[model samples]
Target chain A: AQTVTQSQPEMSVQEAETVTLSCTYDTSESDYYLFWYKQPPSRQMILVIRQEAYKQQNATENRFSVNFQKAAKSFSLKISDSQLGDAAMYFCAYGRGGSEKLVFGKGTKLTVNP
Target chain B: GAGVSQSPSNKVTEKGKDVELRCDPISGHTALYWYRQRLGQGLEFLIYFQGNSAPDKSGLPSDRFSAERTGESVSTLTIQRTQQEDSAVYLCASSPTGYRNQPQHFGDGTRLSIL
Candidate 1:
């Protein structure tokens, strides 16, 4: 069984500043995928970024990027130039290549202050 | 539908009553998933469907919970003798494939309340 943990329950960043949300996971599988998802006030789950365990290089999508340390079993998400729209709940998820289940963390509430 | 669609956006039922939630996946999507989200908690996997293959019910919390998907289209999650603890948001997602690399698009979810 894989379990994702988000130690930070809440995070805040000033507008235009940067913020990082921490995430860690426990998985025995060597081949797997890590994902960051955002849920805004609308409560819609949106994919933020994704990183593959085999890919040593981190994944970046516009302002969202991930710091994936496979050896440490850590995958953190960084949001640069944060805006008010970035205020939401962020979740870290883990899943295997052929598996349909995604294990998710409790989530980190991000507050972007003006 | 253009995206995953969950019907009866909000449903309130009495305890011990049966409730059914429906999901319409995006056209052409081959994978469908059901998850439960309790207040202030993370999402929990419930069931999964891939094309016409045998559905995965391993994540179901109890025998009272069951789900069925028609090919690659609609899906229904049924809860028999619902309990107050069953109050939560039921979310549905669809992906082009069941592969981990494929991102799953989610629905707004059905808010189920068992009173």
Candidate 2:
């Protein structure tokens, strides 16, 4: 069984600053995918970023980037130039290459102060 | 629909009542998933359906909870004699099949409250 862990329960960052949310997982599979999902007050789960275990290069999406260390089983989300709209519950998830289900970690609530 | 849509944005039913939550996935998606999210908790995978394959009910909490998808378009999660523990937001997501890198698109979710 694969399990994701988000050590931080809550985090806050000032507007225009940077925030890094930590995530780690335990999986025996060699091929898998990692994802970060955001859920605002509206309760819609939106995909933030994705990282393929086979890819050595980190994935970047504009202000959102991931530091993926496959050997350490660590995948952290870095949000640069944070805005108020970035305040939400961020969840770290893991899925195997051939699996249809995703294992999610307890979310970390992020609050951006203006 | 332009995105995944869930019906009954909010549902309040007494304990012991049965409730049905609907999910309509994106037109071209071949995989649909059902999950439960309690307040301040992460997503709990409930069931999964892919194309015409047998649905995975391994994640379901109990026999009271069952789900079915008609063809590849829509799905319904039915909870019989709902309990207080069943009170949570039911979320639905869809993804493109055979694409390992595809991300799942989600609906806002249906919040079920048991009184």
Q: Pick the DockQ winner.
A: 1
Error of 2 at A47 (Å): 0.7
Worst-scoring 10-residue span by lDDT in model 1 chain A: A41-50
On residues A1-114, what C-alpha lDDT tens digit does candidate 1 reach at each position?
A: 789999999999999999999999998999999999999877779999988899999999999999999999999999999999999999999988888789999999999999
Per-candidate DockQ vs. reference: 0.76, 0.73
Error of 1 at A8 (Å): 0.7
- Taking the tens digit of each residue's C-alpha lDDT, what string does model 1 give over B1-115? 4878998899999999999999999999999999999988899999999998899999999999999988889999999999999999999999998876588899999999999
Q: What is the lDDT of residue A56 in candidate 2?
A: 97
What TM-score fits each model?
A: 0.98, 0.98
- The TM-score of the first chain in every model comes to 0.98, 0.99
Show model 2 residue runs off by greater than 4 Å: B98-101
What does candidate 2 score in Cα RMSD to the true structure? 0.9
Calculate model 2's interface RMSD in Å: 1.5
